[model samples]
Structure formats: C-alpha cells, structure tokens
Target: MEEVEIEPLGADEARDILAVAQDRRNGTRWSVALALGLRQCEALGLRWKYVDLKRGTIRVFWQIKHQRYRHGCKDPHACGERLHRYPCPKDCPKARRTSGRKHVCIKEGQKFCAPDCTKHAPSCPERVGGWTFVKPKGKSKRTVMIPPPLIPLLKQHQEAQQAERQAAGEAWQDYGLVWCHTDGRPIDAGQDWDEWKELLRLADVDKDARVHDARHTAATLLIEQGVDISVVQGILGHSQLTTTKRYTHITATLSNEAAARMGRALWG
Candidate 1:
C-alpha cells in the first residue's frame, strides 16, 4: 500500500557508506547492507549455521519479530498488529484470574491476565508466551551469494568474534548468530537504526535514504549492469515480478542510451 522510495546509491556514495561503516566499527552490518541488500531485521536474525563462508553464500529465512514497544490490545475483536497483545500476568493477585479464586493487580497501568484463556471463544496466541523470532515475509526463503570482495571481510570478522567468544567463556550466550554482541546474542533490530543514521551522516549521502534503500541499491545496480530480470527477482526473493519492478529504478538517460545503442546496432 505504501509507495517504495527511489533512493539507490551511486557507486561513489555506496563506497562512502561502506567506508564510513568501517570507520564507525560496524563493518559487518554495512557490508551486508550494500552487498546482499538484506533488511536490517533479516541481517540481525542470521545464525552462523545459515552463513557458508566457504561457499560465499548466506541463507535468509527468518527475521527477529520486533516486540519491545507495544503490549496486548484492549480491542477484544482485533488481534492487533502484534501477537503479544495479551500477556500472562505474573504479579496479579487471584482476583484477576479466570478461576473462581480472587486476584489483585500488584502492577499498576499494565494489563494483566491469567493463562486460563477460555475467556475468548477460540483463544489467541497472545495468551501464549512472549514473541520471538518469526519466519520471513510470506515465509519466503532464499540463498544469496556474497559479494566477492566481502568474503575476506567476513572471515576477519568471524575470527574476531571467535576471539570474543573465547574470552567470554561460559558467560557468552551462544545463539549461533552470524552477527552478535560479545555475549553471542542476536543484535536488536530496533537498535540498528541509530547506527545506520550515523553511518549515512558520516558518508555525506542523502540522509533520507532509508536503510531499506540499500536493498533497492543492490537490486537496481544489478539490473542496470544487465543481469537477467529473473535472476534479479530470485536474488531479491520477490514472489511477484511486479514487486521487483517497484524495487528497480531505471534512469531516463540510461533507457534512452540503451534504445539508441540497439537501434544503431540493428540499422547501421
């Protein structure tokens, strides 16, 4: 429903973004941002098992479900945008329980409910535990080849992470994510934006270019360089060719030049 922004970075600006990302100590995320065009959420959810450095390919299947901000819904009918709209009240007294026993709200200004979800006709997933990682959009899965130049950078980063893990020993939480904190837990997607904005500012590029525009940059650059449309579509994991079209931005000068070149070859 929302129109996609046409904000592909030129080669120079792309280089600058990568340069600044390295300067800012976020080389891995920025490299993936430009090279593979991964959404920040997808990048954050990546596990080490999905990354094949030997083969220069990365698997994309899951994304971290963002759930820190909003809680359960007051609306009884609507499930709300988030599934964790309703939460099990851990501190409420017996007065709030679905059971005949009494309950009290120890924590104020927060909705509380018990696990006895029979209050709703069919019940809801919110009645379950909190939200965690979720499948990719439409559950679409794809493998993307890493850029040739980025393989070595990834190797170096992995070595550094290995050292960090060794140092942390026992304290490290091994989530097996490709990119994580010193504790080995996945990076928070919500926190990714702050670094991205700083990177854009340092690069001196248009600040309005959303982090998602990096994905568009990848898609558009590959197409302009004459890769087959089907291959581009597959790389983008787009179910509809039309969706790929939204991501592609063909400049008028390039289009006219292409037309003239074809005419010259055919007639002259």
Candidate 2:
C-alpha cells in the first residue's frame, strides 16, 4: 500500500480549533474525534447509549455508512427518464475529467443511451440509498476512554441537545445519536465535513486540512505525551501497531526532547 500523509494540528492549533468549535451545535462531536481518534463514521454514529458519562468511556460499535442504491424495480429499462442512464451530453461541463464508470453508460458505448436503457439505480422508484448505522469492522468496535476535560463538554452538549429537542417538539425523530440535527435527524456526512472546514476557517488553522486529520492529531498528541505505542493503538482501535505508528508524525518538540534525553544520559 502507498504511504499516507500524516498532517496533524499542533497543540495550539488544536486549542484554537476547539475554542472556535465550542459555539457550534455539534462542537462535542469534533472534541470526541480529536480526543479519541474516532473515524468520521464512528463519531457520527455515536449514540447516547454507548456513552457512559459516569464511567468516562464510549463504546464505538457502530458506523454511519452511505450504501449505494440498487435497482429495486422489476423493469429497470421501463423506469422513467430520470432512472434511465445517459451518456455524457455534448455540452457536459465535467467531460474533461470524467472517466471510468462515472463518465459514460457502460452498455451504451460512446453513443447516447437508448430510451429504454436500464440505469441510474439512484432514481429507481424503490431506490434504497441513504445513511444507516452499521457495525464497525474489526477492532474499530472497541471502547475508548473519554478524557477528563472532555466530560464536562459532553454534559453541556447533552443539555443543549435537550433544549433543541424541546424546541423541535413533535418534529424530533430521536435515533439516540449523541450528535444530530436540531430535529434529531442523522447529520449528513457532507454537512459534517462542511462544518469541519468552517471550524478550521474560523480558527485560522490550515485551510486545506481534512477532517480525518483530527484523528492524526490525536495519535500524535498521545505519542508526544509518552503514551505507549500499543496503548495508542488500542485507543485508536487500530488492528496493528504499524497502523497506529503511521498516524503519528514526529514534531520539533519530540525531536528536541529526544536530543535532550540523549544528552542527559550521555553526560551523566
């Protein structure tokens, strides 16, 4: 496998981002991601039942995944124009970069799709495309200890959510998610990403930082604090120590500390 780039926020940068995120509705969600190194799906799928405020632990059992729609109609070709697949239009704006399965209808070659061509499962009358909670694969389902400082934030978030629920009244559709929309609906992953970008912008941090980088930040921070590599692996729910090591990056402080330790040992 190709090496993955690991760019993590510094301590000050993380503080800035958290301080900005505090005013957002799902602020605690970001906090949990940073503190626990949770995958985006795990954090979004987290439910109140899995969170033990008294025990200060969170069981990461579920992940919110967007499953692709499949054709449920008996006669896909007979489906409406919206359901029929089409080749790239002559004036297609995305033609320059389109390729593979996303570009042209595989069955139609380079020609325009037949009027009865069966395609675009997403538009089928009985389509089934949406987000649903599913079990996390492998060791990702392990439990994580919540940091002491984050406990109060979680409580405050819960109280705020209760207020939102009351305001929503009959509109609320509780799925027991620790973080959700004001109406208790599951938050779309796209929306979650947008919020992360907005938080970075507000915090004046790296504008190009990806949301998953928060997990990298958590791993790096743990290693910097002298946490054992195996312990960090367990906390991150990684199946292998090598995977956990990949998420950690060496910082100037770590280098300086290593040099200082070497100098002290050698001189003494």
Candidate 3:
C-alpha cells in the first residue's frame, strides 16, 4: 500500500472550503471534521445518541462495516462458512463464554442473552468490541477532539441545525438537540466528504487536500498555540505520546516566537 500523507490546509484554505460547501449538511460535516479531527468513518458512523449539542461534545460509539451485521462462524476451527449471529460459535452452547456483557441478544427466535450484558458473563455471546472508527479503503482511523475556538461555532451550528429540523414539520426524528437530519439519521461521512471537496473547489482552494489533513491542522494549530502536548494527546485521543510527538516541532516554533519577542524588548 502507498503511504498516506496528512497535510493540513492553511486557515485561509479551510475558510475557502467552508465557504464553498454551501449545503447545510455538507457544511456541518466539514465543521465536525475540523472540530473533532475525526476520520471519515468516525464522522460518518456518528449517531444521534452520541452527540451532546447542549454540552458541545460528540461521542463516537460504534462503526458500521460493509457487512456490519452479517453473521457467520467466527471460530477458526469451525467450518469456513459464514453464519448469522445466532449460528456463530459464540452463541452456540458448546462454545465457552469467556467474558463480557450478555446484554439483550436475541438472534432469530431464540434468546442469546440479556440486553444489558457485559464482558463478565461466563459464556459471552457478544462479539469482542473493537475500535469504533473505520477507514473507507486506503485511509486509517484517527480520533481527535474539537478545538476550543470551534466550540462556539459548533454551538451556533447546532442551533441552525435544530431550526432546520423544526422547519421540516412532523417528519423529523426527535433527538432533542442533536445536529442531525430531521429524521435523526447520522450524516453519511463519505457523502459529506465528496460534497465538502466540491465546496473547496468552489471556494477557490486546492481540491487535492485530503479531509484527514484537517485533523492534522487541528493538532498543529493547538501545538502552535502553546497548548501542552499531553492535553493535545487527550484531545486527539491518541493512545500513545509517540503518536503526538510529530507536532512537537510546533512547540519549538512557539519558543522561537517567544525569543523574538524577548530580543525586541531587550534590544529595542
């Protein structure tokens, strides 16, 4: 596979992109991408339940695969035929339940476990949970947080989204303040990206910039602003510090700026 490079657009370019993406849905997707530094899939997989518009926070829960719910034999030793969740080794009586919530798992007509099941159950029926973010084909999933400056914009955007939903009459799904469609469906991230790219072209910016670079921009901006590296790591949701160290050069940049200021004060 070819290496994927993340190159964030300058603020001017981001502004151009946003200006060109005139559609409300597309704009919201771009705003979310710039704010949360979410991968394409993470943004697309975002559900109504995960966003707290009131609190200005987005929670990512689960990801949808191409065969999201396609069930089949998961055990390596079992026959190589794909099975539904009900027929999987995890749900079979012969399989050992390792650990996890049984929650309410009803496959076909038979009951698999309670709805509130956890990982502690002796015969865990639920498949092991993995990372929530997904990549389309060549991309990787990266979880990053919204910047503080964008918080107000997100709030205003939520209000506008709510007004739009209300104008749609009774067809809207009521999730109470979520910045989604009137029917309460999560915005499709891939479609959103396509629209955003078109918008960038319209705004007279380079269309070659990948959406993932917005995340890199968010991180780079924060580090340039003298925000602590650890805090950036938390906001970006990086599992390790090494992943965040790439932006340490911004810290040096800031230090150079500070030294310049000191020189002006001392000599001039």
Candidate 4:
C-alpha cells in the first residue's frame, strides 16, 4: 500500500480552530468532525432526527454522495443530434484506441469527436444521477457519543438554526440536516470545502490542511489521551485496527511519555 502522510493538529491548534469556528454559522459542524471523527459525507448527511441531544449520542446511518450521471434515455446515440459520438478520422494522428479496434480523437481536439461526444447528462430529461443520501458502509454505520464540551455547542447551534428557519419562513426547504444552507437545503460539498478553508484561515491554523485532517486530528488526540487503541478504533468506526492506526499520528510528546512509562515499569 502507498504510504500516506498523516498530519494532525496539536491540542492547542485544535482548540484554536474550534474557538474560531464557534462564532461562525454551522461552526459546530467542524467541531463534530474534530471531536467525533465523522467523514465529510457523514457530517453532511447528519440529520437532526438522528441526533439525540437528550441522550448525548448521534446515530451515523447515512452519508451524502454525488452519484455520476448515467444515460437514461432509450437510445443514447439518438438522444440528440449533437449527442452522438463519432469515430476519429481514419488518418488522424491524435486518434488513440479506446477499445479493441475503435479509436477516438483527443478530448480537446475539435476536428474529431470524443466518446460521449457533446452529450450533456445533466440536461437529459431522464437523467439518473445527482446528490442523494445513502446508508454508510456497515462498519461506518455506528453511533458516536457526544463529548461533554460539545453538548452546549450543539444546543447553541440548534438555537441559531431555529432563528435561521424563522427568517427563511416559507423559503426554507426543510431537509432536516443538522448543517445546511440558510434555506434549509443541503450544503454542497464544494461549498462545505470552501467554508473549511476559510475556517482554517480564520483560526490561523495550517492553511494547507484538508478538511479530512480533522479525522486524523481526532484519532491522534484520542491516542494522546491514553485511550486504548481498540477503543479509538471503535470511536472512529474503522473496520480494522490498521485503519485506525493509519489515522493516528504519534508525536514526540507521545513517544517520550511512552519511554517514561516503560522506564518506570522496568526500574521501579
């Protein structure tokens, strides 16, 4: 397997990020990621119905995904005059084999058509793909306990959402997502990513850190606290201990602590 570089935020850095996020809209969303290690899809798909504030738990059953479009029309070739793909010119130097004998022009070449031609799946009357909520993989579908510090943040988020709902009035779509647009529609993944980048900038944290790094940070934090590896695996909902280990970054502090414990056990 290819080696992955795991860069997790320090405890102080995590605190700074959370503190900055607290004042922004949907700020609790970032906190959930850093504290609970929820995937982006899981966080986006989280619904208010699945969050039991009274019980201090969240049921992670679903994830939001953008499915690719498929040709739903009866005749893909005849769907539209411009939609039909044509073979490359016989002597065209740019033609490359797409299958056993067929060849097509380069994607940017204007002289010859490429596969799918000018087909616009989104414009298809019977297009069959878009953003939708689906069940998470068996292992990823697990309940997460709300951290004590996060409970009040969640409540505050609820109050803010309620205010937004009232302001939106009849314009709200009411998708029931915990984190959504002001109109209650699900937030697009791209928009969510942009927001995360802005949060990092505001927090003065690593600007290059990806949103997924929050999961790594959570795993590292849990391990640093001396939480058992198996327990961290369960909290992360990883199917294997190896996966959890991959997410956990062992820092110098953790290494030194381990050495001290070993020395005490052997010398004492």
lDDT of each: 0.71, 0.83, 0.57, 0.82
Residues 16-90, candidate 3, lDDT per residue (tens digit)?
A: 666655455536667666655665555656655666555656665444433332213344222211222233445
Q: Report the candidate with higher TM-score, 1 versus 4.
A: 4
Model 1 stretches with alpha carbons more than 4 Å out:
1-3, 68-131, 247-249, 259-268
Return whichever of 3 and 4 wins on TM-score.
Answer: 4
Question: lDDT tens string, model 2, 21-96?
Answer: 8888889899988888898888998999999999999999899888887768886656655434466776666665
lDDT of 1 by residue, 168-206 (tens): 999998777777878787676556776777788888987
Model 4, 78-150: lDDT tens digits are 5553544456677777665565677644446454334345466766678888778899785888888999889
Better of 1 and 3 by TM-score: 1
TM-score of each: 0.71, 0.78, 0.56, 0.77
lDDT of predicted model 2 = 0.83
- In model 2, the worst 10-residue window by lDDT is 104-113
TM-score: model 1 vs. ground truth: 0.71
- lDDT, model 4: 0.82
Per-residue lDDT of 104 in model 4: 47
